[model samples]
Target chain A: MSVKLKALTKSIWVFHLAASPCNNCDIEILDLLTPRFDIERFGMQLVGSVRHADAILVTGSMNRKARIRLKRVIEQAPKPCFVIALGNCACTGEMFAPSYNQMKPLDEVVPVDAYIAGCPPKPEAMIMGVVALIEATLAAAKK
Target chain B: MKGWGKMSDKATAKTTIIPIGPYHPLQEEPEFFKLHVQGERVVKLEIEIGYNHRGIERLAEDLTYDQVPFLVERICGICSCSHPFACVNAIEDVGGVEVPERAKYIRMFTGELERIHSHLLWLGLAGHFLGYNTVWMWAWKYREPVLDLFELMTGNRNHYAMFKPGGVRRDFYEEDFPRAARLLDDLLRPLIMFRDVALQDPVLQARTKGVGVLTREDCVELGALGPTARASNYCIDVRKDHPYAAYDKVDWDVVCTSNGDVFDKVVVRVLEMVESAKICKQCLEKLREVDDGIDCNLKEIPPGEGMGHHEAPRGEVFHYVRSDGTNRPVRYKVRAPSFMNVPTNNRACVGYTVSDATITLAAIDPCYCCTERTAVVDADSGKQIMTWKELLRLSRQKTERLLEKYNSRMDRIWT
Candidate 1:
């Protein structure tokens, strides 16, 4: 029973948060859950609430509203939680960075453990990033 | 004694109070409602919105025409193409630029693909609220073909980035057309099957039929447009009434319903997907008939204000922009269908059970996560809370209570 539960915990359940991102990251995020990429097969489920998640996957850069929500979700996540920043928008705010409402890389607002870079990263690339994060989570558990 | 007797002529009445928003999940944008209820009937509903506001309209004013397409596309990802397409179409229309024939055909194809995917997405979301996760999963699975086509043609899903002021930013070659056609044909059966199951299932019908019903009288007074308007038996469609792009050239019927319940809305969207597929097939045939040309001409856009409307999967999407003839727009306004329909919540869900309310409200084709923000707050004092987890729990509890009240009321009325 203990072993089975440990395995479950080792596989990270991701809680996704979006800022003022274009629709690109949204679909890329959706693709993460579907069967083709199948991030869930790795036990990486897309969870509903922040508390239940092992890592928070953030897309888009920080907007005024997103900044507050990002802090809330990050703070709510349990200890030793990982963060995977998806898309160029979350990393550099891309073209939307200089806009009146947006802030720079999500890391400026919250500490991030990994980055998945693309205009909007492809689904396969998103899967790879999640897999890497799960391994990192498992490694940390071993430690 | 005379003064005391004079004051006895008037009487004051008390009314029931109901709260509907600030946290209630809605299909449209976030809005708050305070309804005065008397025995399952609404006397008056006071509304408050701007809670989910991010000021996209204000932000659009500062962007260039080229930049505005990308910015506007962010308004609603489900209908991501519709925004940029409408923006560019309006810009081009005002500028007196005709997109290449091939570009127009491609636009039609992508627009139809978007319709297919967006409707399927709504179907999935609608299914999730009704505790039917299987339908959600299945609908989303079939939706992948549309997304996959987007990736194959435009190099990305969601925001295709294909639209330019005069034409498309990208073009398809001889080889790409056959591959896309093959993929689309492969996807048709699954879509038809899903539609059949969704429409015929007794469980789905029971949950949706006669729930959150909006009469035709309510629709016009509320200014409801698109599927929401059509569901109430209004024969209004931007594509048909104000034919733009290749809609004039394409042959299809506007799928509508008379029963303005959740089921009718679902039927309209599902049938619309079939129409969208037919349109896609038509675009493919047209593409085969047309010759290759430059997708866009990097032309200068003169300063002007233009209003453009496109039928998104949800409903009518209106884009208003003012260009300064300096490649940037001075003012931009987006009227997403969901934004317009957000006000109709009290009318739609007033008599329905709260659980049914979720299904019915979402049936209007609401864009949920894109148009909303979540914050943890104290229920008693309305103070900001420390943990989202606690807030999430509280919000769920509130919804559950509302659902219970709604169910109990239904029981009383029916039994």
Candidate 2:
């Protein structure tokens, strides 16, 4: 792993962006911070500002209105920022995939580094997906 | 400003507007609130929503009756069961289908369990908003077992796909009752502890009590539901007022508090948790007496319109379904509790400070994702003065000040 990538893995602050989502995915994201799952132990914390974040955790599907805001948020984040798509809606648009309002999936809107797939993926799955994303980033940097 | 000219002439010169989230960290769902304040006191509050609009009702038109349950389940994760239950109830009402007695018990069990988890989740969030980290941790920790039970029974923690048109998708096995009862028994101690903390904690009382006052008359006029209305001493629980499922058969009292403030909202939710636990235990005992039977029997829905309303964790989750004797529904309307409760903020927040307004807005347990919808325009300078985080910090700072005051008092008493 490159020195920068290795250092990046030490602490990753995520800003949760809700693009039109059913709340199941958002609750699961919050659940990760609670005592049982406790994602803070891994040095992954949720920050209030997108500017202070190393990663953007996007939940929900990208609707026409939210798409504009999502773009602005992605652009505002510093370079080397990763996007982790959480839940089926974010990754695949799931139930709302064909709706007139929904524009695109998370990847089409912003390049996603990792995808956690579930109706609303469990906290354990979320942690594993995030950890794997960090490892993959480090591996890519080395290559 | 374009919009400020219409403001009350008395406070026109002094008001400064602070915007709270179309996409703010404090909000789990995307909602925008424009708080017009005069020296930290909120004079006028404007709410803008629709950021999370998936048009599920419109989408339901394309999906069949069976498919709509899973679709409506996604309306809000916390109240997932309520929507599907309401939807299924509406379909059953249209078709005139008889759900087996056992299925009714199962539906009640899942609905009550959802209530327990959702209330705990809200309590934890409320504690977090109040700057009480310990309460947040403890409440969420206790909530895990409820989710575990959901996973064990319905196969998913959040969106339990157990509801169908006539009945339910899954049935509880005879062996599961003993373990379910045991788990519920375990939850009682934590619930009591949470209740005690909410009742006796000086800081909590200072932070919440009398902060956001909603009158009983206002609650009724505004069409508030569940604990939001109940907290205001408006006794209108769907279970008691219009019992569906096995609610009429089971015995549980509606929890009501007269204060109509944020503290009363907390009180109503905590007390309701106790009631929910009792209902769950009773349902378990009753389930053992019923014979094993099929949970759902698919029957063609005749051409008719029917309404289904259930007491969701937040409030009344009302679903209206119209069928044309086809497989799909022609019109499906969902009115979640937050829909009715959020607008009441217009009246509830006016007399409070900005710090208190945060908790007051939260007191309704406003589901931004369910509402998914906001825009903030400053009336005075046409520039945004405060972000949602700043508003959250303002709210948290009040609690910190209260804690400091409490600590100093303790120190003086000790000396």
Candidate 3:
């Protein structure tokens, strides 16, 4: 049972939080789940709830209304959970930065461990972002 | 009074509230649906959207004619071109700009390709929600080639940004047409299989058929548009009623079904893919027929107000632009299909089980980004007076009254 548990623990469970996204980033995130990208190969599985997540994937810019909800979701996740900002809207706010609806950049509200930058970052970029996050966490653990 | 998420009112008997989002797996955007459930049946559904309120219309008022298309394209990632299709139409209407013949075909081609992509995305998501993971995987696999086609032609998978005021941004190369045509051809086999498999699958029919029904009266009264309306046996297609671009020139029939159930909605969307593919083929043939270089021909604008509506994948995306012969539109009004279609859920979810309500809402293909664009204004004063709090209070009162009436009726039936 411990051997099976150890083997299972290697796979990461990710919770996706869509914070007032136009859904471009969210849809691209789904692309990683679909068979074409097949993120399961990298020991990644998308969990439904934040509590079950090892990592939280934050998509979309931080809008005023959703920012509160974003914080709540982040709080709900298990301790030492990594938050990865996915796409330009989440990473840099992009064209929607000037809007009154937006609260602030995503990194301001949540400590974004890594950023996969694109209008909607391609799935390849997303895989690399997760790997980089894993490496950084490993390096930090070693230190 | 805090926000739509808070359950402040106690006017009705308490029921199990299954709050789906601000963030949920069922939907990609941050819209909340509060369901009042009694056992398995859902008595009421209060939709609290506006989380994805990017303030695009207000932003459009500030942007120039050239920039508005780019801004509006981001309204919904899936319906990326739908907003711009309406935006450019409004601009051209104001300027009385005659788009080149080739541009019309290119617009239609891109628009149909977008329709195919958006519908496939919905199909894949619908599959995912139903716990039909295989369907989700396969539907999305078929969709990859469509994105590849988009990448091939417009250089980006989503947000093609092909639409400009006068015409398309880039010219269609003669070489890409055959390859693009071939890619679209690849989608047909899987689409046919999907339609057949969905129609034949008993489990799917049992889950979806006669579930979340919106009657014809309910559809018209609620002003449901697009597939939501079409599923209800009501035919009101913007492409047919108000033909724009090459839609009038091309020959295609509006796909409508008798039942307004989730199953019929699925059927309508699946059948419509065939029609979109057919239309794209004809548009491609015509594009090759017409001179390729003359994709966009520019003309100057005169002061005027113009309205444009496109039959987006969801429904009609109506854009109203009033230009005072200035570089920017003085007022830009966008009415996405979901703006009207979303309210139909008020009736659609009334009798269905709690489990089925999500699929019913998804059947409308509600784009929260598109629906959250509007703000209430005093018509006489031409100014805003009602605060967001006031609006919430008014809506909550309505919700409370609905809940009270429904629970009281439930008590009578149970007793």
Largest lDDT belongs to which candidate? 2
TM-score of 3: 0.88
Tens digit of per-residue lDDT, candidate 2, span B194-299: 9999999999999998888999999988888889999999999988988888898988899998989999999999999999999999988888888657455676
In angstroms, give how far residue B212 of model 2 lies from its true place. Answer: 0.6
Per-residue lDDT of candidate 3, residues B287-366 (tens digit) = 88887454455545556678999999999999988776668986787888997888788788877888788788887888
Candidate 3 ranges with C-alpha deviation above 4 Å: A1-10, B1-14, B292-299, B374-415
TM-scores (chain A) of the candidates: 0.84, 0.94, 0.90
State in Å the error of residue B235, model 1.
1.6
Tens-digit lDDT track for model 1 on B295-322?
Answer: 5565687655577878877678777666
Q: Judge the docking of candidate 3 as incorrect, acceptable, medium or high.
A: acceptable
Q: What's the lDDT for residue B254 in model 3?
A: 97
Whichever of 1 and 2 has more TM-score, that candidate is 2
Per-residue CA lDDT of model 3 for A17-127, tens digit only, reads: 888788898888888889899999877888878888888888887777678778988998887678889888899888888987776898888788888998878888888
Q: For all candidates, what are the clash counts?
A: 2, 6, 0
Candidate 1 stretches with Cα past 4 Å from truth are A1-9, A21-24, A137-143, B1-55, B296-298, B368-415
